[model samples]
Target chain A: MEPVDNRAVVDLLGALAYAELTAFDRLAEDARLAPTLAGRAALARMAAAEIAHHSRLTDRIADLGIDPATAMAPFVSALDAFHNSTRPSTWLEGLVKAYVGDGLAADFYREIAAFLPPADRALVEEVLDDTGHSDFAVREVRAAVSANRKLVGRLSLWARRLVGEAMSESQAVIAEHDRLAELIVAGTGDLGGVAQLIDRITSAHTDRMKTLGLNP
Target chain B: MEPVDNRAVVDLLGALAYAELTAFDRLAEDARLAPTLAGRAALARMAAAEIAHHSRLTDRIADLGIDPATAMAPFVSALDAFHNSTRPSTWLEGLVKAYVGDGLAADFYREIAAFLPPADRALVEEVLDDTGHSDFAVREVRAAVSANRKLVGRLSLWARRLVGEAMSESQAVIAEHDRLAELIVAGTGDLGGVAQLIDRITSAHTDRMKTLGLNP
Candidate 1:
């Protein structure tokens, strides 16, 4: 096996750490949109889970001798732009975004984790592990979508936009970080392998949307 | 010992639960003001701690055969009003609010918890336990005030306003809930007991402000 690049590892962890941090911020903000206290608490719980993941990622980055803040700084703008662009306007939209948007990012990271060294891969997998709150999102979104078929159209459009914004920001991040891009290409065995990885992520995203009773 | 009044217990727990919920929301929102990712994560962790306490409080409320949401509904407006009026405009202010404002509330609750049944008292004490993040707030606020002596006057004023608003809203809440008010009065042995309780909380608040290098 080829040796892994340390800078690439830092970049990947940095990006992932920032992603979790912003996920916490957005989900917590979106909780206020919940119509009920119970609903709000559920969303807040999901946001808390993101913070825990973020702390772990930052801890691992620190163990690698990088200042976690410095490492996370590079990706802050891209992730923030993605979240800012995809802000959910309502409780149901927030639920769907948490389910679909985070699921897509997790899937992509899992795909890339395969190319990392064992330790980094393990950390990635641990951080990406579902917080078990997806069931709440899936249950809530499916119930709402089923009750009002009209929501199907709007939420479906929202989900697609979320994916589009995510992918655009992700590509920009990769483009700016050559080590990260090289790592992805090398892990895939070639550019074709990267294409296959994208295909896998897209397919999983479709399944996730379907599970949420939304169009892919 | 007089049997604990179920209505009063419910009211107290409800108020505390809603306070936790809003604390989670406000702290998470304030985290965006943090100057660095590490500082943001620290505040986020504090916010997450509030959610955990909220979950426990809600669970305890449910155990008493009340819907957690129903229990929390009554205090929502009061708690929300307090947070809305006391929104922090900067990172240092947010840290001070979390430290001083929450410390004041916790001191008040701990005083009242003494009059409750063992189980209810235990729950109150547990939820009010500091999340150990106060050190972070103290360290940061002190360092900032020392570097910029001008911050002391503004932040001291902020701290006073926080307590003033807190006391005003708290009086409103207690006035509206006869049973909760009775609980506090009885626990203190009379109306004077209530005043003494306020005195204790006030003294603690002053000490907290001093610790933060701000005048009370």
Candidate 2:
């Protein structure tokens, strides 16, 4: 593994920051899909955390002497496309998306955080890890699953689709961000090594599915 | 001013909390109407702060052994009616709603906060106040008004309608919750005193309008 530079780390942080911002917006929109007021408020609270994370990352990007919007631009389309292609059609679907989809994304982010420089890495770690967020999602998904065992099949399928879309976007981000790819290479070596990193993401995702009592 | 009891303070705090939660949800939804990413994000950030306020109030309600949902229920219809009656039609109108409408609402909450028990009053004073939020709304409105002088007239009309609806709802909440009304009465005394309070609120609002370069 080679050593990563400041620019790649900054770009990576920028992408994560904008991702959080956009997620907050999208999840807030999706909260309307919730079946109950409690559900709606829960999702809105989660969305709020995303924006808070975005604010922290934005501050870091500014400290790096980079315009936040400029640094965030490259991943906008990939992130938007990920969301657009996977709009949930129902309350259950929305919950599933928030639970299953975000878990996988966070796992990938957790892996990438290790590749960042110490200060940048801490920011990535801080922003990407949302324990309050994940617990809520997991609990919501579990309650729904327990309430109606029949929901498992459809939810599992939805979860799979969300995972697939996320994987596609993750690959697209990698392809475009040669600098980021370079950073990963510095930390973990060759392209094949990077591919293994995704396999690990997939394994963690399966663990999440099992945690939700879904088939791995 | 009359002293406030725990139940009355709880009612007021719960109402404010739910108002913040609902505002966060609606503003996040309305953010989609923004033509630019920056505009959407600004609204999203504002919405996030509302949730942070909501969480604090929710915790306090729980501490008082009240169901947050039950405490929130009475104000929901009035809040919904107010927002529904004053929906913005343009991006500038949205900014005006955020600036003028939220400014008025925050002012009202601050006034009411003074009528509560000491702990609740301090919580209300501390938790709901965010200078960052008001500054963003002010900046957005100022930019819009400065960019197009004609926007002032339409937004002024919108502001009047928003205030009217808010007034109607405020009266409804007062009528429905006698204990809460009594707390306000106790804090400021009878009809004449309350009228003076209203006058103060109105004067402050007028000053806010002038600051926005809108006609009072």
Candidate 3:
């Protein structure tokens, strides 16, 4: 096996850590859109789970002898821009975003994880674990969509927008961080390899959207 | 001791449950004001802790055969009003509000806990545990104040406004909920007992402010 690139690993961890932090922020913010106290609490619990994962990723980054914040700083703008541009306007939109958006990001990260050493791979996978949010989002969105079929169309469009914004942000992040881009290219083995990776991610996202009864 | 007042117990739990939920919301929102990612993560972690406590309180309320949402519904308006009235405009104000505001609330709740049965009191105390936010807020606020002497006046005023808003909201809540008021009166033994409760909470608030190097 080839030796791991420490800089690439740091970039991956940093990106993941900041992603979790923002996930926590956005999820918590979206909880306000919940129509019921129970719904709000469910989203808040999911948000809390993100912070726990964030702490784990940051701890691993520190174990690598890098300051977690310093490592995370470079990716902040791109991540913030993605979230800002895709802010959900309604409760179902928020749920769909949490499910579809996070599902896409998790799938992408999991693919990247295969390139890391075993320990780092395990860390990435663990942090990306669904934290029961998938079930909650699925149940909520499915129930809502079933009650009002009109929601399917709006939410499908919302999901597409989420993916589009995420793709642009991901591209920006990769373009700005050379080592991170190298890690991706190295893992995929070529530009074609990267295309195949996106294919896999897109396929997974379609399955997720179908599970939520939304159009891919 | 007198038989536990089930309605009062439920009301108290409901109030605390909603309070924690809003605390989670406000703290998570305030995190965006943090000057650094490390500072942001610290606030986000504290916000997560509030959700954990909220879960526990809601669980106990459920164990008593009450729907958590129904129990929490009564206090939502009061709690929301308090938070809306005192939204912090800056990072230091947010820290002071978290420290002084939460410190006062905890002090009051602890006093009320003494009036409950052992098991219920234990639950209240457990959910009200500091969650490490106290030290973080104190350290940050004190450092900020020391570095800029002019901040003392602004933060002190902010702390005072927090207490004032909290007091008025508490009055509204107690007046609105008859059983909760009975719990306080019965526990304190009379109207003077209620006065003393406020006195104790106020004194502790003053001490917390002093600890943060702000005026009471």
Candidate 4:
């Protein structure tokens, strides 16, 4: 793989770190929409895990001697736009957004982990795995839709909206960060390789949908 | 101790649980005002721990077959009012408020734990101690004020506002929940004992203020 410049890496890491911080804040607020105490706590734990990810990424940014906020400044609008546009309005909607939305982020980080230098690679790797709270979301989402059966149609629709908004923001980031895109593309060699990456993300998302008994 | 009604225990647990949930939300929001990423993450983790406490308290509430929200409802307005009225306008105010305010809750919970049934007592005992995060806040507050010297005067004044607002809301809660008050007075033995509980809370606040380089 071709060597990426430190500036590009810093920008990437800062954007990722800010994303984690905003995710933590957004998901923590979403926890309020939970129908049950168990559900609220489950989402809260997920929010908390984002802070851990935020910490690791922020530490790396600081070690590089860049102002973390300055590094993060460029992406703030896009991230905030993503969350504001896709804010969930119901308990079921919140769970689906968290499960489906964060699942996508976990996938993206795993893919990008391979492109990073060793120290940065390890940070990405550390963030790829899920906290146990996904099961809490799964349990609740499954119960809600499965009990009514017809509610699957509604939730599946909600899942699609989450994906759409996430993809929209991701495209905005890609357009904004050409250097970062070059790194991902350089690692894979071509559009087909990018297609394969998308395929994997799509498949994992499908598996999640099936787990919740929603039509993929 | 006379047998306390299970319903009363559920009410207390639910109130504490929701309080933790909202505290998590508020603190996560407040963390953004921190001057450094490390500082922000520290506050976020402290917020996260409150969510964990919420989880434990909520589980106990569910075990009692109560709808957690219903059990939490009676105290929601009063608690919300307290936070809304005492919203921290700056990073220092936020930190000092978190330190003094949560210190009060932890202290009160310690006193109220005595009035609870065994299981509930254990829950309160577990939730009361946040030694690491409290220590982190104490150190940060002290360092900030010590470095500037002038800031100490400002924060001490902020602490006074926090206590005054808190006391007003707390009195409302006490007046609203006769059973809870009965349980507290029963456990403590008299109005004098209640006064002593307040004294202990105040003494702890003084120690914390001293640690933060503020006047008691």
Candidate models: Cα lDDT each: 0.91, 0.82, 0.92, 0.83
Q: Is candidate 2 or candidate 4 better by lDDT?
A: 4
What is residue A13's positional error in candidate 3, in angstroms?
0.3
Candidate 2 chain A minimal-lDDT segment of 10 residues: A128-137
What docking class should model 4 receive?
acceptable
For residues A1-216, write the lDDT of model 2, one tens digit per residue.
456777887788888887888789878988888776677788898898898888898889889998888888898899999999999888778877877787777777777778877888888888877647667777878888999998888788889889888888988898888987777776766778778987998888889888787776
Flag the better candidate by lDDT, 2 or 3: 3
Where does candidate 4 stray beyond 4 Å?
A1-13, A59-77, A117-123, A138-165, A175-179, A206-216, B1-12, B61-73, B114-122, B139-158, B213-216
How high a TM-score does candidate 1 get?
A: 0.98
lDDT of model 1 at position B164? 92
lDDT (tens digit, per residue) of candidate 1 on A1-216: 578888789888888998999999999999999988998999999999999999988999999999998898899899989988888888999998999999999998888888888999999999999989999999999999999999999999999999989889999988998888888888999878888998999999999999999888
Best DockQ among the predictions, by candidate number: 1
Candidate 3 structure quality by residue, lDDT tens digits, B26-142: 999999999999999999999999999999999999999999999988898889999999999999999998888998898988998889888999999998888776799999999
Rank ordering of all candidates by lDDT, starting from the highest = 3, 1, 4, 2
Better of 1 and 2 by DockQ: 1
Regions of model 2 farther than 4 Å from truth = B1-5
Estimate TM-scores for all models: 0.98, 0.93, 0.97, 0.81
Candidate 2 residue A206 Cα shift, in angstroms, is 0.2
* Candidate 1 per-residue lDDT over residues B1-216, each given as its tens digit: 567789789888998999999999999999999998789999999999999999999999999999988888889888889998999999998998999999999998899899999998998999999878999999999999999999999999998899899999999998998898888877888778778888888788889988999987
Which pairs clash in the backbone of model 1? Answer: none
Q: Give Cα distance to truth, residue B134, candidate 3, Å.
A: 1.5
